[model samples]
Target chain A: MPNADGYVRTGRGSPPVRTPTPRSRRRGVASAAALLVTAGTLAACGSDDGGASSLTWYTNPDAGGQAEIASRCTEEAGGAYTISTSVLPRESSQQREQLVRRLAAEDSSIDIISLDPPYIPEFAEAGFLAPVPDDVAERVTQDVVQSAIDGSTWNDQLVAVPFWANTQLLWYKKSVAEAAGLDMEEPVTWEQLVQAAEDQDTQIAAQGIRAEALTVWVNALIESAGGHIIEETADDPADIKLGLESDAASAAAEVMKSVSSVGGPAFTTAGEDANVTDFEEGDASFMVNWPFVWGRALGAVEAGTLDASVPDDYGWAQYPRVLEDEESRPPYGGINLVVGAYSENVEAAYAAAECIASPENQAYYFISNGNPASNSTVYDDPEVIDVFPQAPVILESLENAAPRPLTVYYSEVSGALQRIYHPATAVDPETGPRASELISSVLAGEQLL
Target chain B: MSTTTLPPTKKTEPVSAPRGGLSDRSKAERRLGWRLAGPAFVVMLAVTAYPILQAVYESLFSYRLTDPDNRSFTGLSNYWVILTDSLWWESIAVTVFITVVTVSVELVLGFGLAMVMAKALKSIRPVVRAAILIPYAVITVVSAFAWQFAFDINTGFVNSWFAWLPGVSADTDWFGDKWLSLLVICLAEIWKTTPFISLLLLAGLAQVPDVLQEAAQVDGATWWQRLWRVTIPNMKAAIMVALLFRSLDAFRVFDSIFIMTGGANGTESVSFLAYRQTIARLEIGLGSAVSVLLFIAVVLIAVGFIKGFKVDLSQARGE
Candidate 1:
């Protein structure tokens, strides 16, 4: 039973005392004086030097993984610029919040930015995105995914381009496909994948082995089945056009439930670690993730910590097309960069973005981090093909992937669905009613965005 | 000098003293005292009062941080939306629940620790106190990570040990379970904050005279009886201070829940909800409305507490 004084004092980096004596008094004065001195020094350090070529870039893309790519750009640009970068700690929603705060503060030091998708619209709407010159926007439009442009578009203005694009693609292990006695070359229907997953489970189990078929998947079920998580208008939420009421939507949920009931459980909360953890741990033989996981997971599998053959010995396919008659459409899941509409140095920022969008720099990003190009033509590049063999197959998914609805109330609308149809609504009993009610409310403008 | 001496004898002249009474000081001295402390006062005003005022001002308009230009006056509209929303009300309930549960648990745990420490032998007291403080000593992020790892599905130690417990499965995912995840967050908070409360109580306990306890024991009063009548009444003032501080801190908790559950699993606290709306959804006007509401709530609480306890706080502190 010691005094809690020590603990409290430690937070302040001092010991508890009744009051300051002459000796302690001196220490306090000296510290204050030192702080003032430090402040003065910092002020002097912040004075304009006028000609520094250090470019500060904000990104959370592989964080440290973007360095070599940046260095190469600086080198190719003849060292007129030295790239410095900071990684945003949060992704998507959280990142947008952090960025807004920074921009509102109007910091002069932020020379460059890397915005995530979904953020592009807000920034673009707020006019925070810097407008790229016609020439630059033209070059960018050619190389990046069309979906990537959505974040950068506002009133027909091009504000940013894709550093790398992320489109969710289907990844199935070769052994698992063979075990299920399914043909990889054949197009997979949602029903076919479900059937194959179970059959594969049985074949593997016949040898006293175990594997989960019908592990969790997104895009395929959500958008393909015509579920609309985002609404374009701020109206009565009750009229939301979420595809929950559609036949495909119900079918996807019911099919997912059936697959789970037959011993093919969805991915548990082992923390998908961006899907790699799910696949590499053998909990799933396939998953939907952006391209980067491929590069990092490659080492683990090769080292035998993971099933090495899972990488090369696999099949990549675009998300299955929904039944033609169904209303759901594929929604693209990827990253996009937009100009900070509030930036004073719009031209400089645009120039930097152009540098990143340059074919060589884009290739550098692809080589270092395995980021896929948004540029449609880059899929056909020999160098790109050699680096990412799955690129060609994944490209098809991008073309079909739909943009999440663009609306200010997108968060509220999406949140409603997330709440109603949690666990993919695939197996949850109350989800059908909940999702139906939520979607109805959204459509009616009585629910949310 | 001779005339003044004569006059002083006649009037029995007052002698000068080292320290003067209030009347002896000039207006300049009083003004100087206020001046010496002025910078700090102004700083506090800027840092605190300004933000509060800003929140109020923002609440009066449709303030969007992203769309700075569109922050036009839309008086009371945001407030109207929040008050009418059932989801907003649910957040209010969740925020209250977290605050009540966390503060109550911390108070009890902290008191128990304080009691143990207060009675320990001088030589061993420091060690025991330090041991009790180990939880609070860890940084919040590290502590959060520790709890998160303990509950991690694949590598978490809780899963590893769960099979040893009766009737529980090894593979149950703790993070996905709503109430369970919230409980984990609460536990993390209690573990971190208990020491702070205990220390405050311990300081209060030290001021209770030992003579009263001895007299009670001589009168054949049991320990519980002595504590209730003699110790606790003596500790009341300290307890109030600790309670107010703890209550305020707990009411706005956001970090642990955010880290552990990502505010998912149906545990959206008011602060987290505000964050999601303002930052995540770019609903700045709504966020400002929440901030203004929170400010008013705190003010009302303070006023209520003061009215309920008619005794002057300064006088109690002095005693």
Candidate 2:
């Protein structure tokens, strides 16, 4: 290249040299790198702004749902917030795991958590959730049934808002009882109930039907029997007494095994369906179920689609009295709604929770969802009375319902019981030694406790 | 490509060449390698690295799912609690048991099927292969449910068939019973995962030389003898790859147990228990500890594969 104007063609000397100095060039590179880094950092921090700050509602999506209750609520409160509703899997195990991972991850994205009451203590204790507002707690403490509150409170603090009640109830077929030649006037003692089912077993079996009843419904029977699942011992804070191997437990277990004969030619009378479906078919003479069965089973019964497998003369029992001790009463517990401590908008979340737990919503839960109301105040009210003709019974069931031991090892305990229940592990029916041994192994609590 | 090269360039360049010693590459070329890998690297770091770091940090605390005042940094206590606990060991035992049973079964069946398919009539191969895939094609949950229903009393087809039994004709609650549940899960897993294994082995089978088998036969070796000597020796690399793949998958089992028994009835694997603690109990610290332990187990198992099976993971695996 040559210089301009009067310059002749030549090398560097003829060229106008304007390359940046090494120092200037280094500065330019450093400044550009700094700009990029700053921009990146800003981008990273700004991620919380868009499509976030909007509150998320994790719940099951209803088929007929407005489908955007969260968004609607947030909108009604003005543009200050946007609420996003995420439909999470409703399976019990799945729900529990997702909640744990989110909180463990320190996920600030989720501000509201709908907790099942049995799980409330764990979340609250782990500091994943904030305390309920004092006013809300005080009011809920009064309005909510004590049984529901018992499960939701951890360390004497209100950790969740009671969504609705789930009190166990006796569900028997009114019509099937008639066919089985039974009177449905009053609840039968465990023995009498078995006898009555035995009376009609032949006929039921001949028709290819089987009678069924709950084996785990001992809590109610415990209260009625004067036994308890766990008794708080005044003797020691470190001690919780379980009557699992006690006479009460044996009595309950005997009752469960005895009841399996109801519609059976044999063990075929018992299956996983003993929990729910056994009573769905019109042939079973009796069943014990919670309120959810009302919508799923009774609705079919009322609609005439199901033959109302429960006896024509239905029987209701809170739980059959197991040990008959005055102090041993069955406990009631279910799920509850909680606000996450990591949630940014605590007040908004609180308000949302309050709305969800309102008496009207409680009624809706009873009528539509087949869940009993957590609020005791709504029980005798004319509205709930219509929704659940058995509402009075459920209310009574709440006063002295049993709650599972809220220990960290509760799952392990339940799992142990389930394992022992498996026939292979269960001792020979002729002798329960093996089953007893397994239960003892479970009770030994080496790993989980 | 350059078999005959020029004579070696005798010390043309000094040993300590300037910083720019090699090729005169452009800045873009220098950066292209990193840029090409940048997205995947960033993604890998975000997905795998951050969670692991966070889990390791959380493993020091003793947090309870049902209690709040209980959440505190216990400084390695959570790990101690898990490691020292008998529950952890039992779960690990169960996990190993399930993994070994299922993976070993799958390997044998898969290899057998692969061998058969490799030598079967060409016209029937496609049909047989498709039939094998039908099981793997079925969703895990669906397969579990099907097994649950078939073996179930009250409604299962198994019970109806059992009615014809000499004495135990009643509905026995097939999977609800211990040992039985494990057996059912093992069967389902074998059925579902065997095809994937077989397909891999089939690829390996493609590489085995027909001439090698003929040479073995020329020595008057029977089918079993020839298979054990010639075929298996040749397929060692593929078998190793398949074993490693299936065993790792089986170790982290969750779906079948979750659906069939919810970790009840002695079917709980380490992952299922971890899930229960993390989700059901809402104990973040404990759950994270469990997770860290799981990752360690996986690492150990991976090393075992390398050492035990003589796997060269640096090369392609489970191809």
Candidate 3:
């Protein structure tokens, strides 16, 4: 993963020393020497003085989907400019760190960025992103999902163009639900899902790691109960108000405690990937996860790693509610296209970003990468619906999904929330108020955590 | 790169210079020494000193990487905040716990291995030496991942093997509990680094005179006494060096904790906390404060170790 500073971040996020493959290990000495020379070269050419026509897009690491999009957009450039992608670190926080550091330095090599939705506010607040051109903004925002548009906006201004949107659906095993006598067509509550899992002696796979994933889960629950983690937010950090002391928060905490009581043994350490691994083993009866699981299960079946009938039993519904009467607000996540303020060819980069986020491209990305599209029109595409039979459910979830707290201090808020609510079974009514105080104090810069 | 090019030609010529009047020869030697060290000094300052000074300067401000324009001079408030935070102290406590446990265990285990290599069957010395170095050769991250997988309930065998033991569940999630996660982190640390300690101790063992052991034995000294009195005292410098290096390395432990538990379950070391604060949270001001504290802590540890052992670092640096 090439960070904006041209440093390779390895071993997840802890340190730079990663496990090298045998080939790299054999060439370690040569690579070390090469790295020193490359570092010097990168320092000398910190801007786009060499080739103005070539644009560099710093994309979050994905499984070849963004790379393909870059190639497609390059073709669509039609000799205007060639776009190349540099993969950022795997972790979102690391990617943000690298970009923030480089952009702070006004490194002009950063022409485009695939930014995480929660970070757009921080980047925009710092003036790292170029103001969206009116023409491009109108075209990009015309047919996109409302939640995606909301996520791309910071302080009522659209700082980024929506590319793709993601929201979790309640995936279940048909046989397990049947065994528990749970209806498939009706909206489910977290209480009912937990009881059903308990009745059938199965697990509900969900991310519970003490990271951003935990914050995502907590925010979704709270939002579904008609409460926002931050009931009111402002550009000024001191003006933020956390809604954690409300009854809705209590309801959310109760649901979490109940669900976690019956979660799998590795619930505390389980990330999305770990949850999916257990789900694929047919041990989990239900899971709340992003759309990628749909493609993953099919691929597993096609590879004969999973039972052929598992796909037949696969089903999905809207995100679970915290209360029986309230509608669920699933977690919203996605990539947004942001033009760098320091880009030499800002117009061309914006044009390429538009090309990359067009409806046709969004539909293609959805079909290929299993990431739901931000463009609502893409959901109605015949190929998208054909590939994902539950496309409507994902689209509906995206429509109602609530994003994590939108603030320039989102990192501090989310980090504190994760620390307080982790080990999900331990969350209680008091957790809400405690987390609120901690988040408030931290964001106000009166406390350190 | 230029430093690498300049030092190779005249490296041996300085030592062979003819004797002269004391003042003239000393002046010439000093000039030559400064010329030889000048490039290295500049490069070192550029790489290490600049960043540290920048960190110190940033720590005095209210700086956020994401909010560049919001920076303001805070004048030591960041340091004051960190010093008062319970989380900072907890991280320090955890780091010290890991450092002490892992280094002590490694010392005992490494000493045993080194003894075997030094005094065991001569015919198997080559095999023993190679075996002892295997863990040292494996990458830290790879070993950490291996240990993580081994302790994971879903993918590992450790839980299954311990299932039959009392109070051990077959589905135990080692990472779910704080102490257990620390245990696993220490296990990975000890597994990866014991070999390095052993290799260093093995060098010390080679310097222990066999004739002294024979004389002690002929004088009716028991094996245990000879080992405690003669062999240990003879290798005291080596032991002090090994302890200082290992302890310092262990105090900065980040890779295993990050890979195995990700500083979750209260297992975060000070370095892990710094990384989270700086890279993950983007609180450059607060993070730099933490970094400066960590640097001071490391320096204190090195000085404490060196002073405690009376190890001459000037000699260690081959002055």
Candidate 4:
């Protein structure tokens, strides 16, 4: 017999080969064609750089605020260079990952970046940021927020230019404060605030979720109590110091436990959004959050979702103190402008960064994006004061704000801290010591997570 | 059907003879086979095999993306650290638990669903099938968001609707506790994937031969007895195939956990742990190590199922 239809071979010492059916053979050809098309498209993906040199500035997701700034900077450039904005992932860690990957490969297309403050040290240590020019540094640093300057520096060198500075404020309702017979103008300790919430039969909203926000809260509480997470023994991981088990850390944990325990059912999982939502709807009377809440409240009122008088009823003060006598240190958060080390247009990038973070632009960003300006002059501007009635308190809070631990291993430290201190009520004196040890072990490569 | 056209093996050759008598036509046919398979094979190798090999190569180094200059060869230290770490073990345990619970639950529920679709009237079969497939068609991230919102205390009605129960409070947070959070994650996974399993099983059910079932019924066998002895035994291949696929998918649960809890409340799966290291921390070396371990674990799981079930995988895999 002869083989027929070319679909099978069954003879002599060979294993059987079942050939493809006509339909399957057609599918094979189709799929192969598709693969070629895909490969061709991938190969064709190269930059179409026309005559003009374009700078790509990577920014955190900011609802087109950064895009507006990019366009403004480009127009101001007067044909020297064009600026384009590429939105980074919304999460700070994700943004860091993308930037780090590109910088490690020395991708020169990355001209500038909007950086989270805590990751500045890591980027600077890795030499991913260009050194700030002396003239530009002097121009940007005048009347800047101290914490913003502190956050953008690594090894005493200003590696990035400060753009905006954010610090949490103790926001409360006037009715809740009066009901509890508490003064809103003077400083109030966390203990006093918790008691007042109990007295008024209301809740305090804070970020308790296991995220960078939780780490920010923990660091603030510890810093306010005169404790530091890392002592900066050296840039080396083995020499890093942790003050997690100190008396100040214990005090911070005490406040964390109390606030989280009494916060409510979802306290363990509440984040910035949850707390803000609850506060807007009157579920909570007190919240410690970034200045963005003020703009959110006003917007809600304008949108008719909130009562007209709610903005008037809102009151603000400096972040609550961890102890009665100690001055409270608000948590600092903001975006910094950093020039990419591998950028072909280093001079142009620095010029654009300086222009974008100028006092006038900082004030504009404050009003538009709700991000507090790092330049103190921006706060003193009449328009900023008119828009933010609590501008003075914000300036004061930014002064005393405690930046999160500046470490080259911030991602590792933050992850370990969030893990050990999660469900904030679980944080006790022991959590600090445990977290410190874990951080040390993780950094030293003895532990992996 | 075409077997009669094949050349007789006895006349063709002895067992040890070389296949040297092939005509030019046969040689051209062999070349055509390779030519047709070439592009897809190359693409598959580039996309899949290259990354896997690269991951294995990177796992041997001490590489952090940020600290690019500091990378040095570390031999097996990365793997050693992961093996010794309790967090890795915890993630693996969580992954296995999720895989077992979700796959088992999905298997039972999917079978029930497939049965309904299979047994329904011809007129309604299309509608029932479409409805069953709706969850599967929804994007994984979107379905996860829907479940996350539905279970949220402030934004959801689940708590208020179930508040009358003794232990269920009106202010309950579904993601607060470890067990409950895992339960909710499993619920989301099952809801999304049970339809897929049902679709596969439906095909197998079609091949189960209703005449055998009717004969069993005529012989005085109860419905349950017929199901256990006749129906299940006949659909063993389908059941095994579904288990193999669903279990592998469930074992790598990431998106739901990442969105709902961000791996908090002790809910991080192995894939999530790998993600945190590789993407969040930029620790490429350690992340690759974790990925390799996860890959090994998946292979072991597949082997276990294949060995225990004695499954003839060629049936499901096809020619």
Largest DockQ belongs to which candidate?
4
What DockQ was computed for model 2? 0.17
Model 1 Cα displacement at B219 (Å)?
Answer: 2.6
Query: Per-residue lDDT of A35-106 in model 2, one digit per residue for the tens?
Result: 999999997885566542556667643322212345445656566566666765544445766777778667
lDDT of 1 by residue, B139-190 (tens): 7766777787787665577866777776345656666666777788888989
Candidate 1 vs. true structure, TM-score: 0.83
For residues A1-449, could you state the per-residue lDDT of candidate 1 as single tens digits? 00101111122222433587999999999999999999999978755435545566777646344666566666766745556677665445556667777877876556667766645655666555566678877877875666667645655666667666666666677778788776667556556666776665521110000001111133246567666444233433334455555555566566555444332222323222524555655556655555555776665655666665566665676654444355323445445555555554566566666777766666656665676677777777788888788877667766666666555445554555555544432455455557657655543323222
> Which model is ahead, 1 or 3, in terms of TM-score?
3
What value does the lDDT take at residue A435 in candidate 1? 64
Show the lowest summed lDDT stretch of 10 residues, model 4 chain A.
A1-10
Encode model 4's per-residue lDDT on B134-238: one tens digit a residue.
888777777787888888887777888888887778787889889889988999999999999999888878867777777777888877887788877777878
Rank order by DockQ, top first? 4, 3, 1, 2
lDDT of 3 by residue, A214-326 (tens): 88899999999999899888878888888999998999899889888888888998888778777888878899988888888787777777887877888899999888898
The lDDT per prediction is 0.62, 0.62, 0.85, 0.86
Model 4: per-residue Cα lDDT over A298-345, one tens digit each: 877887888878778888898999878889989998999999999988
B47-155, model 3: which lDDT tens digit per residue?
Answer: 9999999999999988877777778999999988888888899999999999999999999999999999887798998888777777777778878888888888777
Query: Listing every candidate in turn, what is its Cα RMSD in Å to the true structure after a full C-alpha superposition?
Result: 9.2, 14.8, 7.1, 9.5
lDDT of 4 at A236: 77
Overall local distance difference test of candidate 3:
0.85
